[model samples]
Target: MAKLELIRNFCIIAHIDHGKSTLADRLLELTGTVAKRDLQEQLLDGMDLERERGITIKSHPVRMEYAAGDGNTYELNLIDTPGHVDFAYEVSRSLGACEGALLLIDATQGVQAQTVANVNLAFKQNLKVIPVINKIDLPAANLELCYEQMEEVLALPREEALCVSGKTGEGVKELLEAVVSRIPHPELLDIPGTAALIFDSNYDTYRGVVNYVRVKNGTFRRGTRIRLFNNGIESEVKEVGFFSPEMRAADELTAGSVGYLLPNLKSPSDTKMGDTITDVKDPCPEPLPGFKEVRPMVFSGIYPIDTADYEQLKASMGKLQLNDAAFLYQAETSAALGFGFRCGFLGLLHMEIIQERLRREYNCDIIATYPSVIYNVYMKSGEMIPVDNPVFLPDPSGIERIEEPIINCHIMIPSEYIGDVMNLVMSKRGICTNTVSVDARHVIITAEIPMHEILIDFHDKLKSMTRGYGSMDYEPAGYRADKLVKLDILVNGEPVDAFSSIVHTDMAYGRGRQLAERLKDVIPPQMFQIAIQAAVGGKVIARESIRAMRKDVLAKCYGGDITRKRKLLEKQKEGKKRMKQIGQVNIPQEAFVAVLKATETNS
Candidate 1:
């Protein structure tokens, strides 16, 4: 076993595209964890979606052996974490397993909203933070501005900041040495039995569930019997190993070490992330303070395109839930969509990633409904009901008031684009709470907005208004009473539950008009006219109609009397009117997908 004093556990935290994965690749190369010939960009980003989008989704952990300038070899456990605001929960869980973090900043874009948010999370965990300015090799790199922002916005010391180029591998070796010298070693609590914290877990088709953990005390061996502290379920350890950027077998994992363990469990749901694993016979007196339960902010319904794939979709979601702790789901049936699941996610990006993964990794073709946020509905009797789906909302007469989720949003952008961003925010029903000048050219704006308003296109609009120079981060700020109403879409006088949404009273008319128009373009014309109407409390707000396909009834009346032609047309009209009364509109899968895309861009 390695000595405790020679071990350093740290993770890299930064904003999106700020080079967290790139810096991790350089560290792996310098430590010789992976050979130089085998090195690649974004080695830690294992998902195709992540690589294609140029972002990190999951937190990756690996162990390295670094020979430092002090003449002692050190064992470094590095957890590369995602930088997006949607994945902040992943960053928080990763910080729990490490003693320190590398706070990376881009030299060109010094202080971002997520950069400040990550620093706060690290401080909450009491982890030591080492500030590193990345992308120093860029032509627009401004080191002085970076230092100023670090001091003014982040309250971090300027002298402690280290300048490094993650792309060119400049000063990486020195950064590693600093990691060994500056970052404190992990402190092992004096516990009686083995207690390791499971930070992450994934399912392997051949081996069941594989858990990635950080050993807090004692040793975990191949044949040791273990129990989960949260549920007290016992199992035998099948194997123990470390990630040398890939799984490498080890005889045992000792104190203060980060590694993976295979337990004799068959289902992915059996093991939970942040659960404490300890020896079955001699467990610790108290369970470790695991992570707080993550609350999903956005809710949507996911249905299989082919109804026969329902079971497969369920299994796929189970595996995905094991991988993503922030995702939540339950079985829900819709009159328009049939058997499906209502899934909750952290944000729109997180929701999109999950849908893509279901298609690519699990080969499950799915359709997602328009995203919505949970609302608190208080009735006249003082009964409060939480509603995530509009179909479950009570009658208008019984509802005393509706409270929507609010979020405190922080946006950082160039000073010149402040007017455009402010206008965009005000249009989305947000109130600018404060504005602070970070530097002469940059500004930070804080606002309070309804979570549902931002669930669709707020981030995209912010980026466009600021010319891709703006970044945002947000957190839930509880719920407030509002004039909210549920808008239902009726096709051929039948309300389709899948197209219903809870919207603000002021926006109900415009939003309903947009959705009704979009639906008209996608829903195919039937033999009878289909009236697409958006209604709130049985009052229609917007309406559109698809003209019925016409049949040439005058083809057999050539050279006949005008009365003969008119009688034929009248008979055809009667048939059409009767068909319109009895015919059912079959809304295709493409209509749902088209409306979803339109809402994401225009909402």
Candidate 2:
């Protein structure tokens, strides 16, 4: 085997669609990690959604053998990380595992906000950063503009930025050489203790909890009994191996190398992202940094359309939690929807991905309420509890204090969109911090906005205002005290917990009206009229009436035209028997899906 000095360990970081994944694919093919004829696009994006959306959801590592200029072959470890802000935790954990980062910048779009964030994160980690201006093969590519932007924003030398196109492989060789020249070599840790950072993990049926870790010091072999420093859980290692990225595994790995271990850990709850693996012989004096617990900024209730599918829905959620630890759920029982989970997520994209994965992966149809925020309630006894569904909210007479989360948002758009975008933010309870010209064409606008205000169709609205030339990102910035109220949705004079939402008092008027109008289009006209109202306390701020059907006719019969009305009535009775009775109205499966779609579609 080649010595450790010739090895290179690093990861690629970029904004979404900035050609990070494409560059990884080309590097793999160039180094013989993947055969030329057996190439598949975006090989690192293993998830179906990631492939379909052209984004990376998980951090994937691959090992390749590259021939250096000295006519010697060296092992290259390349880690590919996701670009979206919702997956910041993932990006940070992945960043912690590598010694260096390759920051890819778009030649046409200079230095964007996300690129700056990634560069800053790498600097915080003390990782060597190499800036690569990608898509230089495009006819409109301006290398000088990108170099200047990197120098101004990232404070990197113009000579350090390598111009390359992942598509045509132009200047790729120089970029590879840059990695070896700039990125530092992994040090041989001499400590006797064994400790590794669990950057990410997944559960396997037979192997139990399989964790991916980068050993910072010492070594571990198969059959070694280890303890997790964070939770103090003990387990014996079933096996140890490294990612081949070629459908196989390596026998052993050491400090400064990435690998996986089967701890025989049964439930995925036992292992968490950012947890550490320590030595059975002599553990680390301090545990690797503990997990930074994430609270859901967005809340919503999920119920199966058919009440009989409730058990199936629960099973699907349990299976999903094995692979995804971010989803938070509570045993919630609603008067209208019965038993289901009140789920919480980090943001709108995170919520959408969980809902879509449930439907597509588990094959269960579900109804999700509008995403909102958690409200805090204090009773006469001075007891405080967080309320996700407004139905459980206490009467206003017993309230004490409330708080809401704030976020630091960055919006980059064309110069012409400055006025409309700022107006939209101001209307949505957003305060601008500053604005900077990224280049002559685009401006980076910074603002602080409440998390709830942007949960509903915010991306679409931003795109519309900017004429599809804007991109934005947000990160949680502590909590602020605020007066909040819960808006209850009553259907036919009864409140539905699944439809309730928490909102700031100032936004209650506009939000309630918007919600009532949305439900009016969703709940179909039935045998009896349905009332969709948004009520704060006992008074209703907004109301919309879904009128009952005005005409009823049997369009056709299965056989030839039947003059006897009895035969048609019999068929109608059979259909009604199959339908579900929700309150005074009977609805079919088709109607349920329509309402669910309507619940998601913004008015």
Candidate 3:
């Protein structure tokens, strides 16, 4: 077992593209986690999805041996966390496993919205914050400006801040020394019991659920009888191990170290991200303190494009959810769409990942409805029900009162885009709460808006307003009563429940027009014209038509070309078979994406 005094726990925090991942790679290289010659780019980020997207989707816990100026080798546990707002919950879970955070500020950009949010979160978690200003190699790098921002925003002293460029290794040694001297060593709890907190986990095609945990209070060995507090699951520790990018069996993992436990717990729900793993022989308190069951924030319906793939889609969801506890699934039956899943997710990215993986990994194509927010309704008799889909929503008469969740959003943009952003925000029913100049050229804008309004395209609008120079972060605030209406999409006068959403009146017209135009792009031309209507209640707000294809085939083919033409026709027929027949119209994958992405282009 590793000694407590030899362990150091810290997380790397920064805004997007602030060189957080690059710095992590340098640290691993400096500590010999990867040899100088064999090193690949961004070695700390193991996921291809993460590397392609240029963002860390999950926290990576890596152990390294670094030699200090005092000529002593110390073991360092560095955790790299996602810097995006969509993965805020995951970031929080990762922060819980560490004792300190390395707050990196881009010397050119100074501090950003995510920077403030992460610092506040680290403070709330009681983790020590070590401020490091990165990218001093850039010509525009303003070290003095960054230091002032850190001192004013994060309350870090000028003397404590370290300057480093992970790109060129400039002043990086001083930064490493700061990490060793400034960050507190983990004071591993030495209680006479086995208790660990699961921070995150992933599903391996072969190994099942690979749970990442931090030993909070004790030690555990293989074959230990452990009980998970999240879901009353009891299982023998089939495997007790630590991650070296891959799982390696360890006889026992002591307090202060991060490791994985394969409880052989079939379901990811059993080993939740925040659940406590305690010794079944001598269990801790009734339940863990920080264990709040994760609830999905956005809900949508997913149906296979080919109805034949329905069973495959369900099986895929089950396997995927085993590692992604944030995904919620329930069998749903729609009058117009047949049977599908009422899937829920933390946010848009989470929803998109599941959908993308379903097609990419499972080899099954599926169609999804517009992402919708959950609503709480109180009836005349004072009964409350959580309505996830607008199709299941009770009539307005049945609803004595209805309220939707609200979010407190922060958008940091260049000063040049203030007017355009303000107009956009106001149109989305966002009430500007506060606006402050973060620096002479940039402003931080805060707003309180309905979660539904900004869920679709708020980020895109902020980006467009500032010419892709702005950043945003938001969190759920609470629920509020508003003038909300169920907007439904109708094809051939038949309402498609999957395409229905509850939206505010202020945004209905703009969103409706966008949806109509997108539907025109997505819906394939059929034998007859297809009418796409965006309606509120019984009234139509916007409409578009997809004209039937006039010349979709080769009229005359010579010789061997006839065979090719016949094959093309066969392919078209196969494609049409996968589409849903709405009266005379055929709806394909492109149509579904069109409706889903209509609101994606807000500006």
Q: Each model's RMSD to truth, in Å?
A: 2.2, 6.5, 7.8
Weakest ten-residue segment in model 3 by summed lDDT: 577-586
For all candidates, what are the clash counts?
0, 0, 0
Best by TM-score: 1
Candidate 2 clashing pairs, residues 3+ apart or interchain: none
What is the per-residue lDDT of model 3 for residues 1-603, given as tens digits with 9 covering 90 to 100?
657776777889988778889998888777776778877777777767778778776787877778889877877778789888878877888888888899999998888889999999999999988888888899999887787777776787978788888888788778778877877777745455667888888777776677788888777888889888766778887787775544679898888888888777655555677878899887777554576777889988888766677788899988878767788898888765567899999887777778877887788777787778989988888999989888877877777878999999888888899889888888778899999887677788999988877767777767876888888889999999887878888886778776777877876887677777877877777755678899987889999987755447555555685679988788766665454363444466556655655544432
Residue 95 of model 3, lDDT score: 88
Which runs in model 3 stand beyond 4 Å of their true positions?
188-192, 286-288, 334-339, 509-534, 540-599
What Cα-based lDDT does every candidate model obtain? 0.91, 0.79, 0.79
Ranking by lDDT: 1, 3, 2
Candidate 3's TM-score reads 0.87
Candidate 1, superposed: residue stretches over 4 Å from native: 190-193, 551-572
Clashing residue pairs in candidate 3, if any?
none
Worst 10 residues of 1 by lDDT: 286-295
Taking all chains together, each candidate's TM-score versus the true structure is 0.94, 0.89, 0.87
